[model samples]
Target: MKTLKEQFDILSDGAVDLLPQEDFIRKLERSIATGTPLRAKLGLDPSRPDIHIGHAVVLNKLRQFQDLGHTVVLIIGDFTAMIGDPTGKSKTRPALTLDETRENGKTYVEQAAKILDMSRTEVVYNSQWLDSMSFREVITLSAKYTVAQLLERDDFTKRYRSGEPISVHEFLYPLSQAYDSVAVRSDVELGGTDQKFNLLVGREIMKAYGQEPQCILTMPILEGTDGVEKMSKSLDNYIALTDSAKDMFGKTMSIPDSLIARYYRYACFAGGEDVARMESELAAGTLHPRTAKVQVSGSLVDRYHGEGAGKEALDEFERVFVKKDIPDVIEETVLDGTSLDIVTILTTTSMAQSKSEARRLIQQGGVSIDGTKITDPAALIDLQAPVILRVGKLRFLRISGR
Candidate 1:
């Protein structure tokens, strides 16, 4: 068993907040001395079926707990998914049907397996306990927290002040989530910084339920490929867990040079000492940013997909980006050649995720057609022959139409 201090040092890396840090240390000490693993809870609502590298930041922290011989209770919030978490939403979230919730929940676990150890992980559905609760039981649970306390949530307060119609059922979302901790008897709860409000509620609710309050740990939000907004599937800036090795490598390489070190800390699992050295080299200008990015991109792909995939991806990236050579295997999407806007063409070729993004790249001179930079996004071209399309420094496509 690692000493409490040693475990704390490892667990604290990349974490944004660990509420009442002393409690976490004490829990670690108890777990170590008793040789009893702590139960770490992480709840997920299945509203979003796909998970991205950004989601991995918290999963990685959970894995760290598992490495220390702790039990990870992965609670699929099938019951809660119906209500949808109202956190950070200016308006009410659309409710999910039970069938849609179940289907999404199924994919959630499958994708989470890429990061979580399914064998050791205790996969559970909150529906098991939450579904069985009587109305009286729910009311009793609701009675524990006052409306004034519920209003403490920033998003709730913001929406209320803004006069956005806050739904009454939304209040149940946090209460139900807190009930999950009580059901599982969680010793530690982990989540993204966005989840701090919900996690802290778990602690208070646990204490109210006559259980030891779970220590809360929250990780920083990982920035997406844009290197601007938080990584999100909705933002189309996410690198999905199910992405192909080639796609993963390519997307990771697209991140701005400034985000390479941040990705190292949040996205990649490179050893701490090694990450330190790379950051140092980049900081001192000893290592070229491009070279460091290739390493980061390849390492990330290899970690998720396979060992050698990274090197293969690196070689392919060099051939395409550095040598300005077209890849042997370009995804060929055929379309009718009657007429096509260049912006639409860019999206169809997967060069850009949206028309707006395509236009941005075109206006910035980052897009070219037939080896000529296409400054006008509205340029309509007939794809009679195979046309070469290049976006930014990386993506290349061969578009063909009848």
Candidate 2:
């Protein structure tokens, strides 16, 4: 129902800052005229099993193309994960073993499918093509880009100045990623702003192969829970897409109030006048940020899980966290008769990371037993009765008697 440029703008949300707009428009016009949807490709290095909302920002662009009757090819960088992406790393990321890579890739596809329609999407592993390149071919591919250009990338520049060891194989990473575009003959490639350097490399490589360069669309990076750094698993600041609805809602609520609008506009499907109104409402002090965040949380949870689950999650949050009432369907965990420290119980049940962390949490007035704050880390937890264990302001665990 939208024009080519209009659809492009809609997908980009006016955040696209790629150069050479004319070339991008020309390619898009050609695709529109030919009634061929652009071949949009996004590559992911599945070094981690979980995908976050940050990754979904690009995936949402791909979905727009799909809805507009285009082809989206998702490249699972199984081959590249072995070497790891050095895009913004100060030090090299340790390579994942073949087995680990495979396992992560499987989980990546399942989680990514929450945003992308796998039925309409073509999933590819770069290893199929990258592994086939001969030594001569590899050299030929690497010859297109100079080492100086490689060092120009932000991470490489920082690492070079800091005297961090930049491995030779890391240099090949961008080239291998660029080759994916050439292999797929992609009409467009989508990535976060940090990946613009590598995505542009794809454009150059495509041109060298006597093919029209794919148009690059770079999106603004979504900040993690910390609101100051990029969302990443390594930083322990990401909210995994696979998190339960309650967990997702709670994490979303924990984000700084300032980040709510951006998350709504970019991460969620909120757009156009709706987004404008939300922003205005915030500025006018009409809508409370907490309520707005709850809406954002529900929208995101509905996107990954379902509307029913999202509503249920909200209900659970109100019942347990707001009204201070115990959940009806408490999980019953039958434990063996053992003398366990309360902190140990919290850690063992994943309420906290370790006994020390649990103790800190309790000392901060963040831990509760049966709706009462218990600051004693050395407190004994008897398995003779069921008790509700609360951690911080959100998580709850139901512990039952042996």
Candidate 3:
């Protein structure tokens, strides 16, 4: 077992806040003294089917706890997901069906296994307990927290003050999530900084249930490739765990140089010393940003796509991007006609979803044929020979006449 200081240092590496640090230290001390592993809890609401590297920030911390001889309780919030977590939301999110949440939860667990040791990790669905609670029992649980206390949440407060409709059931999300910690008897709970209110409520609710309050650790939200907004699929800035190795590497390379160190620490889960060295070297002009980015991107690809995949991705990336050459394995689309409009070719090849989008891509000079930008949406191309149709920076398709 690692010493308390070692455990603390490892677990708190990229954490934003370790509330009641003394309590956390005490818990670690007690666990080490007694030779008992601490149960660290992380509740994931499978509101989305895809997991991104941004979500990996907290998971990486959980993995550190696991590596240090601790138990990790992974709670899949199938029940609370139906209510939708309102953190950082300006409007009420539409509720998902139980089936949808369950399906998404399965995907969540599968992807989470990329980081967590699934066999050792205790995976539980909140619905196992929350779904069994009676109306009277729910009322008892609801009585533990006041509506005013719930209103104190930033999202709730904003909605309340703004005269926006706040659903009564939305208040149950935190209480339900809090009950998860009590059910698992977690020693510590982890969440994003936006979830600080919900995590703290877990401590209060656990105490109310006559159990030791779990310490809360909050992780910083990882910014997307744009480096301005939080990483999210809705913003089209997130790199999904399921993204292809090539896409993942390419996307990681596209991030601003400013985010290189942050992505190394949070996304790649690089050690503090290594990340600091890279940062210092970059600042001193001893290291090229592209070289550092390739390392970071390659590490991510290797992690999710298995060994040697990063190297393969790097080779392919260099061939396509650095050498100004198309991928060796581009998907070919055969058309019956000799000539086709740029918009039709784009949409027909599934490169663009709609004609308007194809036109937009053409107007924005994001569409190219054989290294020539196609600015006119109405331009016709003769498909006499196979031509590489490039869209944006990553997508490529070969068009040829049948």
Error of 3 at 135 (Å): 1.8
Task: Find the number of clashing residue pairs for candidate 1.
Answer: 0
- Evaluation by TM-score, superior candidate among 1 and 2: 2
lDDT of 2 by residue, 1-402 (tens): 568778768766745665557777786787788887778899999898899999988888788889888899999999989998898778988878867887899998998889888888999999899989999999999999999988889889888998999999999999999999999988888899988998989989999888989888888899998898999887877888888887888788889988998888778867767878888998999999988998888888888888677788889889877897776676656556555778778877877877777888888999887878887888887667777877777667778655
* Number of backbone-clashing residue pairs for each candidate, in the order shown: 0, 0, 0
The local lDDT score (0 to 100) that residue 41 gets in candidate 1 is 91
Residue 382 in model 3: shift from native, Å? 6.6
TM-score of each: 0.85, 0.92, 0.91
lDDT of candidate 3 over 225-320, digit per residue (tens): 999999998888999999999999999999999999999988988898999999999999999999999999999899889999999999999998
In angstroms, how far off is 189's CA in candidate 3? 0.8
Write out the backbone clash pairs for model 1.
Answer: none
Model with the higher lDDT, candidate 1 or 3: 3
lDDT of 1 by residue, 274-368 (tens): 88899899999999998888889888998899899999888887787778777778766778775799988878767788889888989899988
**RMSD, each candidate, Å?**
3.3, 2.2, 2.5
Screening candidate 3 with a backbone cut-off below 3 angstroms (N, C-alpha, C), the clashing residue pairs are none
Error of 3 at 138 (Å): 1.9
TM-score of 2: 0.92
Per-candidate local distance difference test: 0.88, 0.84, 0.92
